[model samples]
Target: MEKQGVEVVVAHHERATLRAGNMFLKIDTDQARAEIEIDAMERAPIPTPEILWRRPPVLALAALSGTALGRLGEPSTASSAAWAAVGAAVRRLHDAPLPPRPGSGIDELATELDTECEWLAANGVLSTDVITRNRRIAEAALRPWTPVFTHGDLQVAHVFIDGDEITGVLDWSEAAQGDALYDLATLTLGHPEHLGDVLTGYGTAADLDVIRAWWSLRSLRGARWLVEHGFEPNSPGCEIDILRTQALRA
Candidate 1:
């Protein structure tokens, strides 16, 4: 039954998401991940949308109340306090009970980075100088970190905020045990200006160098993923800009 009000929210190789009024319907290729999302949200110590129904590829959730922290490739109008709120929310999530599953291994990411960096260089999508230098910078994040309950894909669009309060965190498919700085790095990836604001709210001593390294690692791999996922990496505040910025850094 095709009625009005339902519209596409996100579409990628793994899944397609739609928004129908106050309902969010996700059709995922990985049913196991869908199950994990439902469980993770239930365990997270934050305001998450209620799961309404779940049946194989399609799962429905109630809409969280509030606007997203910000969109990708755009300037954030959200206040500094709002950013701080996100940091506080993340801190709580890190302090929560760990999920049963673990996130990507550091070795896997290191290998992926090497492969993706090679692809970029071979295809001339990005200059060799930029890719190689950033690859070197990315090495800092390869070390060990105390695993915490992390929102594996903690991007700006995933976080919802109302004034100085974090209303909810969305997209739990990638939630697992991982580095806490990686979450902060993901949230502030392209939005470098907000790093300090988030850190102020995080209220913990995090390694900025490691966070910056994660930014490089993310950008190095993101270009190809964006193309494959039908997204514009060259758009403002996206991976392309982030790479350019990384190249200019000391």
Candidate 2:
């Protein structure tokens, strides 16, 4: 038998994910988050990674088949039907029973957004025009919203697909009761071209303005963290470009 080498999937201060053979190990410093992830996966109606075993800070999972729908700063090669299927899957998750823990409140998000925006401007991370325009756009997301079971960090890379079918979704640590649109926005953050395809399967007409607002809000709130985490937020089709596109459209 051949030995399977371990591959580092992702590493940062908060958590590190490693792939060894057919198993994926997620090591998180905060066990509470891991607990949440475990609970959420057990409760979620959609397909998730199989929990192989757990030991405090490290949780192992069986690998899901297929490739990620897309990645940040890159174009998606998935078919429109595949993107639509993901939207339908997300809708099912949202329409399911709510989780026990609630997500961040509007006041909390507003406070964080303000702090991050200030940091971006002070550190000259973005131009005043870009920051100001996106800030205004971000405000639309701060309004009251009904909470649902949300896959809180539904980045394009989290949802895996084989052909036009969704195989499984990964990363449930951030899952909670939250705004459904926020999940939609996060999924299409860097891939705006697929918004229509997604909405087609969502089965409800969403507020386009609010969706755009979330695009801005998420970028503004996450830019600083991404930079500090040694990730590039300014890559093509990523956060910085999203902000600049919003500004140009204004």
Listed per model in order, the count of residue pairs whose N, CA or C atoms clash below 3 Å is 1, 0
| Candidate 2 RMSD to the correct structure | 0.8
> Whose TM-score is greatest here?
2
Reference-based TM-score, model 2: 0.98
Q: What's the lDDT of the predicted structure labeled candidate 2?
A: 0.94
User: Any runs in candidate 2 off by more than 4 Å, and if so which?
Assistant: none
User: What is the clash tally of candidate 2?
Assistant: 0
lDDT on C-alpha atoms for all candidate structures: 0.90, 0.94
lDDT of 1 by residue, 13-95 (tens): 88999999899999997888898899899999988888999888899999988899988788888999999989988999999
Per-residue C-alpha lDDT of model 2 across residues 115-213, encoded as one tens digit per residue? 999999999999998999999999999999999999899999889999999999999999899999999999999899999999998889999999999
- Listed in order, each prediction's TM-score against the native is 0.96, 0.98
